[model samples]
Target chain A: MREIFKQEIEQLGLDLVSMAEHMSSAIDKATTALEKADLTLAEQVIDADESIDEIEQRIDEQAVSLLARQQPVATDLRVVVTALRLSATLERMGDLARHVADVARGRYPEVAAAQGRSYDILLDMARQASKVGTQVVELLRTNDLALAASIESDDEVLDRLHEQSFQVVLDEDEDLTRQQIVDVVLLGRYLERFGDHGVSVARRISFLVTGDLTNAVAMVAETSPRNSETS
Target chain B: MREIFKQEIEQLGLDLVSMAEHMSSAIDKATTALEKADLTLAEQVIDADESIDEIEQRIDEQAVSLLARQQPVATDLRVVVTALRLSATLERMGDLARHVADVARGRYPEVAAAQGRSYDILLDMARQASKVGTQVVELLRTNDLALAASIESDDEVLDRLHEQSFQVVLDEDEDLTRQQIVDVVLLGRYLERFGDHGVSVARRISFLVTGDLTNAVAMVAETSPRNSETS
Candidate 1:
């Protein structure tokens, strides 16, 4: 019985990692579709998001059932439940990818790129976000506290890229309309928030393992817009 | 022991309601500050958000303890855990309010109105969102399935108002700089998403009471931007 329970929980972790992989690819394709105005890729990303949502729901149910059946106390319960919340965050990341695809699709046939836009910067932001996604799966697999904690540091680059993307758009003097400007703002916000959610999952996993969150609070300061508003 | 558990669970419901009340007011003051560009009120909202985050964390800790100690199964388990998730959502609403205040504070000395924007429509959207917050707390206290279900119907107006807020911004012919345009979009989105979280809580509470989610899915269609993009 003990072995079966242990295996089931391990499988739960695998499912979470699988979902993370799916979400990472979705964001990567989403940005590609956005940059190139590839309707086909955009549609694919949008259509594929259902799978992320489905997997997330499945992981949630599995966690709940584990809680109910095993009634695991202390560390085990935290592991199961925090996995559930992290899955929700991952699901949100997928939705942000979908939002980007939708914007790409909405501006199809027209170059969706803002005038004087930092196209490479935006692509780099997506890559960094996807990297964080990959690192999270590793964290889950290895329970590597060091890897989990590094997301905060890595996210610093993503935050700078996020701000730079906006600066690029804002500084442009040529043919930047209100709609395009709003889209750029949304794009920056989506990419930055993607990193923020990534940080949230990492911090959560680290806290789950070590019960330390000093780094998480500091990290949230850099990524969260609300936190930045006052300072 | 059984009776004590039931009462403790009931108290948990009350605690959630209290947190929701705090969130609703934060949003209220946030919008008022935005409209008046009242820096003090905006500062107040920003500073007070820590209390919301703190309460949410305390509630989370309490819920974990409830789950660990009660070892509740099935419906009882659902109640405790879902309450935890809802508190997270409610906490997010507070963040949205903070976002609003941040925008207000960021645009000091300026009126901070969306350019050629319908200020009343935006204010009305905030009111509707706060209304949903109040209703959800009531539903939690009463287990009023009817009240829970009504959020969908009531949200339709908020959705329309959300759409109109954007249309007014888009349709404007005045000199709306890119920054103003971006601010309007953010304002509309934050207000609309605020209500979406409220509906989510109401829908979940309904599901908690009677195990029906068909309504919840339909209701989300009106508010979630990702859902609208594909449809």
Candidate 2:
């Protein structure tokens, strides 16, 4: 019975990693579409969201089923539950990507002609977010504590870029409406938040392996320049 | 052994519900401080957050210990894992409230004499968010599906209010700085998001009890109104 339950739990973990990968791909496509104002790609990301949503629902169901059937004790229980919570964050990350696509669709003509530098910055942030997502998947797949720790460390880089993007918007004297500037900053923020969620998943993986949340928290604290400075 | 695991898990649930209740109160106090620009109250909320964080960390550690030691299966596993996730959402909710407190502290002098109508709207939103949080706690305590379902329903109202708040900011020709308007709208958004997270906790509880993810997904789909309308 233990062996069977372990297999089932492992399968559920794989499903979650798959969902995370899809979310990362969706964000990548959405970011590219936003930068290029590719209405076609934007629409594709929007339409493809139903699949991501379905995967999320499947992962949730499977996690719950494991809970109902395996009745997994402490550590295994944490893994299943963390999978469920992580799925929600992954789904939201997909939704945020869809929102970015919608924004791109709305401002296609204008964004297509705008200076490429700003879009480039946004793209960089998206890439950073995708990297975090990938690291989360790898951590879950291998149960690699070291990789998870490193992913936690990389979150700070994403934060710095996010802040820099906002500074770019604030310092520019560009002929943009207030709404446009706000939208740009929010877009950066969404990507940054997506990375944060990815880091959260990595932390969960770390906790699952070590039964310790302190290490992940401490790593984040030490690596995060803002938190370090405050301390 | 089953009895011991069950007792510990039940205690964890009660602690989590208690924490969620305290979070609701914290948000209420923070929102009131924001509307009134009451710096002292804001300071209290900020300082009070340390306790919330400590509770959250304690709950997490306890859950992890329960998982590692008990190795509970099915329903037992679900209960413990659900407790951890609920604690996480509650912690983030408290953080959001503290963020509102920070904003209030920053803008107190400028917003002190602002019109009463704006405060009324914001306070109403905050109250609704608090109610949702309370309902989430009630659901956990009683395993009350009906109460959980109602909290799911309330999320729609919160979404509508979120939209209305944004519309008001956009439509008003008030002599407010863009930063001020954004701050107000973001506060409303944060409250709305808090309610949404409460609904999520309710969904997790429903799944834990029924092993059915359908109802939760259906509720989320219904509440997530089409953004195409804005376009």
Which candidate has the top score in TM-score?
1
Off by over 4 Å in 1: A118-120, A172-174, A213-231, B118-120, B213-231
Question: What would the TM-scores of all predictions be?
Answer: 0.92, 0.82
Worst 10 residues of 1 chain A by lDDT: A222-231
Report the lDDT tens digits of candidate 1 across residue range A126-192: 7787788778778777878788769867888887887676666656464666566656666667777
DockQ for candidate 2: 0.25
Worst 10 residues of 2 chain B by lDDT: B222-231
What TM-score does candidate 2 get on C-alpha atoms?
Answer: 0.82
Off by over 4 Å in 2: A1-6, A67-82, A112-121, A141-149, A165-174, A209-212, A216-231, B1-6, B64-78, B112-123, B138-146, B205-213, B219-231
Judged by whole-model lDDT over C-alpha atoms, candidate 1 comes out at 0.76
Superposed by TM-score, candidate 2 places the C-alpha of residue A97 at a distance from the truth, in angstroms, of 2.3
Q: Give DockQ for candidates 1 onward, in order.
A: 0.47, 0.25
Docking class of 2: acceptable
Residue range B1-231, candidate 2, lDDT tens digits: 878887887788778877877787788788778767888888888778767777777788798688667766666766777777778778777777776677677676665214434445666777788788668767877989888888877877777776665555555554545555446455665677687677777787887889885866764463334462122
The 10-residue segment of model 1 chain B with minimum total lDDT is B222-231
Question: Which of the numbered candidates is closest to the native, going by highest lDDT?
Answer: 1
